[model samples]
Target: MGFNEDRKRYLAGLEDKTYFMLGDEACAYGAIFAGCDFFAGYPITPASEVAERLAEELPKAGGLCIQMEDELASMAAIVGASWTGGRSMTATSGPGFSLMQENIGYAIMTETPCVLVDVQRSGPSTGQATKPAQGDMMQARWGTHGDHNIIALSPNSAQECFDMMQECFNLADTYRTPVILLMDGEIGHIRESVTMPALSSIKPAARKMAKPGEDVFGGEELVPGITHYGMGQNVHVTGSTHKANGMRDVTTPHVHEALVKRIYNKIDDNREKIIRVEKDISQNGQSKIGVIAYGATARPSLGAVRAARDDGKNIDFMRLITIWPFARKQVAEFAKNLDMILVPEMNLGQISREIERFVNCKVVSVPKIGGVPHTVEEIYDAITEVAS
Candidate 1:
């Protein structure tokens, strides 16, 4: 059978049961089920719970969990673990996310498969240690220097927090790159009922393995297979510009261009498969207004859209499940048939500006910061103003 059918059967075989849990705890569960055999992370607010729960659970599952000295070491540790053929990950907040940028770039250059969970909080240096914010939206895409592509998913509720973590790991393995679960503090700490699949029935996806003598770094394929350490493959992985065989070729412009383009195109070329969005758009040509949101802002946006519809208003609503590679085509298609698109985010129009790139309609950004999520009434008011 084909890969897609096999994946569907594996998922359908999982036994699911509901549990009331924190978003952070659910992430821990998702990682374990996704066959994460190594976790190395340092404790940080809003994200500490992920490490804490993994510390308690991983060992029982015969997995290793390490509380690293800092975010840099934490990131480096996971990269090393993945080279040993382990599905590895780390969890951290904004400051820690920043500290890992260099290594994150290294992971991309090396084509490592791993997951990074960023439970975002108010930032620009510890704005509020305890509260949540969606300020890290853009940073997840461009925090690391140079031209590259990343896959980031944002969860609006605790349930999504659990569900998306597995998808993150799968995408990482499939693409052979680091994937980020861009969770905000609100959803990370929020308690909700999550349906978790039984561990015994879980079957996670695996990355392609390079056979001996095969080029593990690059080849005719867009994403080359990877070889673990001690695999009898003469693999030379480096951050410098390299050829298809993974040898350093720092002085050749075409070599650098070819390698970088392949890395970027691996994600860009597969945007249709990578991007995901949830839409409740009006189809009767009655709505001229649409609301687009992600993360914490999505919760209230949905509520407001429903309330507005109850009040006889024609408004469409969409929630972005996949945050990076920018969902360019999906947003553009969502913008069609609308005169105005309202974007409510916890940051100052981070994603709205991206939407403006793809559509002809007037884009309105309802930005909120200082650790507060947009309320349903406020979003409803915005919809009403646009409709009037």
Candidate 2:
């Protein structure tokens, strides 16, 4: 489901086809297809290909792509670019994702819509250069050091690298909040076939705008995503607590509450619309066992589900495309219906913890660390043991 004539114009040379590409390259093309006019990122392995591809393609697309000296500046630049009416993104690995933290906070503070791609490699500090780790799952939600809510999407394959980026921008535009596309080195480096987006299905949302002059922003430009952009619009944009028109007012408490509450409200208000979960079909909800997974783990989960079904358990699967604002509604449904809930991820039960918090049922977490994704057998046994 994807594009049209307008979409066709944006990707005139692109079409539905199968091609093998690194996740980073697919991400770059994804950003382009999502109408990204600017890209800023620092080089970090597993994610460097995103920056590299953008460097070559952005200028050609009449978009601006920059390699900021560090991750901090890279994030800041994306925010600034968004204010000027450009959809922007930044890509990095764990270390750079850490550096982008405070500014990510600032993006939250300002209600700026942008994308951050974290191609996770093994690391607390530069741990594995080429290996994959879903270690940043929790970090994506809580790393910035605050009580703020954000959206994070993880992709399992190169195809998702292309598709999730589109979803990332769509979430950002609709909610006017920062959206993170989380991937690990395994998914980011693995090449796979991705079908082209449907031309008619891709309708892009422009930043709701106000004119440059003539009172472009009024009550509509307030904290919630009422106003997008208008040329000559003297909208007061700042990280400080802002008024309806977007001016800074740090000394006042009401403005702070209004601003902060709006950030949370925008996403909270749109939670149902934003949450995305993919479930593999397993006949009439009679699934004997279910494996709940996201990111790269879902890849193996697929195999595990098939194996279980073949072994007579009639297992099914639930995969997540959107992680943050974690698809609790769907997970709850699955938790209730399935005989068992098994969440397998590369990290130590970050998402499984979230799943437990929502549904009134038991959750079994099968976690893996040391930078490697679980094998199909690992997930299969974890589910069957519990189901048995």
Candidate 3:
């Protein structure tokens, strides 16, 4: 019997139940329920709970969880685990995430399927180990030092942290690429009610295994299948520019161009299916103000929007669940009915600048830093200021 048999046996024993858990705990549960068979991680502040929970739960499900010497090794281990046909994952914070960028690029180039949970803390040299921040939005996109595209999701609540973890794994398998669950210390540490979905109802996405003699790296399909190392296949894997069969081809101008383009287009071409945003525009035709937010900041953004609405202000709101691929089309369409869009984030203006690129409306970045979350009153004031 293989992993599928073990997975079925593990899931069959689970029952649907509500649990009061931190967002980090929910992330671990999500990975287990999503059929994660391997986890390799290094303990870091605000993110250790994700690894801790997995350490306890994964063995019960016949999975493996190991702590590596460091973040780089943690990332490298998971990528290697992925090539062995395991659903692998890891968790880390700002400093650890930075250390994993090189290997992350390797995973992207090799087209590995893995999930990375980024429990974000204040940063740019460990600004605050225990504090929350959304400063990594751009880093998650461009930190690897290349023109590659990525799939990243941000969760605003503990439930979302759980739900999105499963989605993150599915997206990684479907795209044959690394998927990121972008969490922050605020939500990662906060305790909330999360109802576990029945294990019987779970439909975890499995990677498309490469057939013998087929091109595992590339082919007619934009996203190619993968041949596991132990499946009696002598497949070559490398970080350099490669041909369809996974052999290095760094010198050919066309090969490099085509390979890089497909790596990008695989995700870019499927943006519609990948991008997800929660929109609330009850006064669509009449509302002139709108707010766009993601991660822990979106929690307060929602409260502020509701408070404004209660005071007779018809302000629309958009909460971003899928952070990468930008959700530009959604934002542009969302902005058409409003004259102003307020972006509340923990960073200065990372996403606000992105919103400005797509929409003609005034995109004001309501930034809050210094290791604290934005208060409802603070966001509400920003909304009411524009109204006045």
Candidate 4:
């Protein structure tokens, strides 16, 4: 947890000032940028670049990157490596993401720390490879087939792609949970100039370093924090259910309740500190219209807001940085006195449903899933079209 200047310099040295990277490239850089020393993945677009680069770059930095036979092996390998005391990660798109679900559930039950990057594409089943889609928004949280709470983040810009990694690693390390860095084709393929972040500013925040036998899930002081693995620690992980030591404990209601509650409370306790949403609140809460968007759609959304305002329509904007635990409390407070709340997304109204559950205002969804991002003109028209 303590910062080391030499380690910081080593990471800083990896950044190149003259180079620009695609969304997938930045995704790899961001993970490596966040202290991930091990990567295991099978190639799947539009996320393949992340794995390709890791294979090339990781070894030079004294790290390891492996291309597994398939997504199943990829997921299993990272979990094993993570428990053996390496900070590991893997990347996949929709079909591969589906393949990784069973092992993902294993990671969840085992309380193993790792990262999974899913650069989403349009899909029901291998629906679209070259096309962009956000259909996996719900899948990231609930795809693994269980009643479990998880952490997932969605970044709209290439810069946020890098920044969210710092937060993602922090969440994974602190909770010893599998954290999802969710991106879609637009942000993953799109390229932009990202000024390299300084290590002094972006420190590697890891789990609590207690000997595993000492305490895996420490009391409130280290709530949900991971104690480093050590020999004789005897951690056994299973997908059914488990105790803090990671052994299956399905028989007792108390252990079951305690297991579930600990998972829920640790995240809840950090919600304020973890959840982030950017606001473009208009003056005096007098706005007549509002739009909430995430992912690549947010790019056009900002212009759409401007277009609406120019036509004498009162509009405000909300951009989500954290997706999984939907920021309801903040969204609720922002909805007061608003006539309507609009959600512009690539998928068929995933977040809109969540918004309606919390806010009294009408939730209007402008949804399209064509494997591409919403055009500024289309979004502008949607705003003006809805306003009229």
**Of the candidates shown, which would achieve the greatest lDDT relative to the real structure?**
3
Q: How would the candidate models be sorted by lDDT, starting from the highest?
A: 3, 1, 4, 2
Q: TM-score of predicted model 4?
A: 0.93
Give the Cα lDDT of each candidate: 0.88, 0.80, 0.91, 0.81
Residues 207-292, model 4: lDDT tens digits? 66555455464345525545444555555556766666666778989877777677667677777777888998776567977899
Model 1, 187-293: lDDT tens digits are 99989998977655555677888767888777888888888887777777799988777889999999899888999999999988999999997656589899999
Instruction: Write down the worst ten-residue block by lDDT for model 2.
Output: 214-223
Residues forming the 10-long window of minimal summed lDDT in candidate 1:
1-10
In candidate 1, residue 6 scores what lDDT? 34
Ranking by TM-score: 3, 1, 4, 2
For residue 92, give model 3's deviation from the true position in Å.
0.1
* Candidate 2 residue-wise lDDT, 254-296, digit = tens: 7677667667776877788888888886766687567888888
List the pairs of residues colliding in candidate 1. Answer: none
Q: Model 1: residues >4 Å from true position, as ranges?
A: 1-15, 199-201
* CA RMSD, predictions in order: 3.7, 3.2, 1.4, 2.3
Highest TM-score: give the candidate number.
3
Off by over 4 Å in 4: 1-12, 16-18, 217-232
Instruction: Supply the global lDDT for candidate 3.
Output: 0.91
